[model samples]
Target: MGALMLKEIRSFLNSITGYLVIVVYLLINSFLLWMFPGVFNILEGSYASIDSLFLVSPWVFMFLIPAITMRMFADEKKAGTMELLLTRPVTDMQIVLSKFSAGFILVLFSILPTLIYYVSVYQLGNPVGNIDNGGAFGSYIGLLFLGASYVSIGVFASSLTENQIVAFLIGVFLCLFMYIGFEQMSELNLFGNADLFILSMGISEHYTSMSRGVLDSRDMLYFISLIVFFSLATRLVIQSRKW
Candidate 1:
């Protein structure tokens, strides 16, 4: 499993695609946080916070993660190597997890460079570190879990198709739906007082809750459930080939 995971990670880093994804993610965020003169600019905000980053990154990952995981299983199937892979000693669960972990770690790497934004904000704070450390920390944690959820979703989407493009589109749709579709549904008033409950089912609700640095166990559980659900779903998708 570890070898397979490493192979996926290496395949990413060895190709221009991996570097391109990281560069694009950082460049967009850096522009919004530092260069662009707007509400998202750190200089324009009154408070010392990378809130703009937390706000913008989810949107970026909505596309970026799909690109990262699009080829995970799709390429294997396209090359007719999935049969060879399945014949290996690993279980379907391990294969799915290895790909998911590699994709998720890449997401983490993409986010790591953004810590420079945090350092910059910390120094620029009026009292030289007067920023809301708790909230900032919480938001970062929330972002990791959010990215993990996306990766799991992407991995499952990849298993659904042999064409990487289809997988990418499907992954993006799933990520976007989980991120905001539920919130929109709740706004329609279809559920009455249950509207809030419906809204809570989306990723945004739990992500926002954790962004406050509250670290609610329920929010963590929701993210874990999402990751688990998709991981298992991917495994099932792979196993279906046996029948």
Candidate 2:
């Protein structure tokens, strides 16, 4: 499992495509938080917090993670290497997890550099560290889980298709739907006072709760469940190749 995971990581880092994904993610977020002259600009915002980073990152990740994982299983199947991989002495679950971990780590790499934003905000605070450290920390954690969930979804989408473009499109659609579509539906009064319950089924409600520094276990569990569900779904897809 570890070897498979390492290979997946190497496949990304040793290639231009991986570097492009990381660079593009950083460039866009950096421009929005630091360079752009608008509401997203930290310096122009009313408060000296990194709220803009948190606000913009989720949307950016919706597209970025799909790009990273689009070729995970899709390329393997496209090049006809998936059969060789499956014949190896590893369970379907391990293969699924290895790919998921590699993709999740790539997301983490994209996010880690943003700590600079946190430090810059800290210093730029009213009294030089007067910012809400707890909230910022919580939001970072929320972002990590959110990205992990997206990775799982991306892996599942890749497993379902041999075409990278199709995988990418499916990933983006699923992530966008789970992140916002459910919440929007719940707001239409369609559930008849079960609106909050329906909204809770989506990622936005829990993500919003955690971003506020609340750190509820329910939110954490929701993310974990989503990751597990998608990972298992990927494993099942891989297993289906045997039949």
Candidate 3:
């Protein structure tokens, strides 16, 4: 599993697409937060906050993560190596987790560079340190969990098909739905008193709670459950090959 995980990570770093994805992710956020004159612009807001980074990253990940994970299993199956991979000593779950961990680490690599934004914001604070450290920290945590959830979903999507394009499309749809579809559905008031319950089913609500600097265990649990659920789902997909 560890070897497979390392190979997956190395494959990403050795490829131009991997570097391009990370670069694009950072460039978009930087332009929105510093250059573009709008609500997301920190300079224009005259406030020392990195909230814009948190606000924009999940949306960015909706596409970027799918791009990253689309070929994990799809390429293997395309190349006829998936059968060889299954014969390896690793369990199906281990294989799924190895790929998931590699994708999550890549997501972390993209996110870590944004800390420069946090440091700049910290220094730019009116008092040179007036920034909400707790909120910033919690938001970072939330972002990591959100990225993990996306990676898990992407991995599962990849396992469902041998075509990378199909996997990418499925991953994007699932990420978008998990992130906001539930919240939007609840807004229609069709669920009656279950509206709040419906809203809670989406990632946005828990992500919003964590962004407020509150470390709620329920939010953490929600993210963990998402990751685990998708990981297990991917394993089941892989197992389906034998049937």
Judged by lDDT, which candidate is best? Answer: 3
**How close is every model to the real structure, measured as TM-score?**
0.98, 0.97, 0.98
Which is the better candidate, 1 or 2, if ranked by TM-score? 1
Instruction: Find the 10 residues in a row with the least total lDDT in model 1.
Output: 207-216
lDDT of 1 by residue, 81-154 (tens): 99999999998999999999999999999999999999999999999998999999999999999999999999
**How do the residues 182-227 of candidate 2 rate in per-residue lDDT, one tens digit apiece?**
8999979978989988899899899989888789999999999999
Cand. 1 TM to true fold: 0.98
What RMSD does each model have against the real structure? 0.8, 1.0, 0.8
Backbone clashes under 3 angstroms, per model: 0, 0, 0
In candidate 3, list every pair of residues with a backbone clash. none
Cα deviation at 98, candidate 1, in Å, is: 0.6
Per-residue lDDT of 207 in model 3: 93
Off by over 4 Å in 3: none
* Model 3 agreement with the true structure over 82-138: per-residue lDDT tens digits: 999999998999999999999999999999999999999899999999898989999
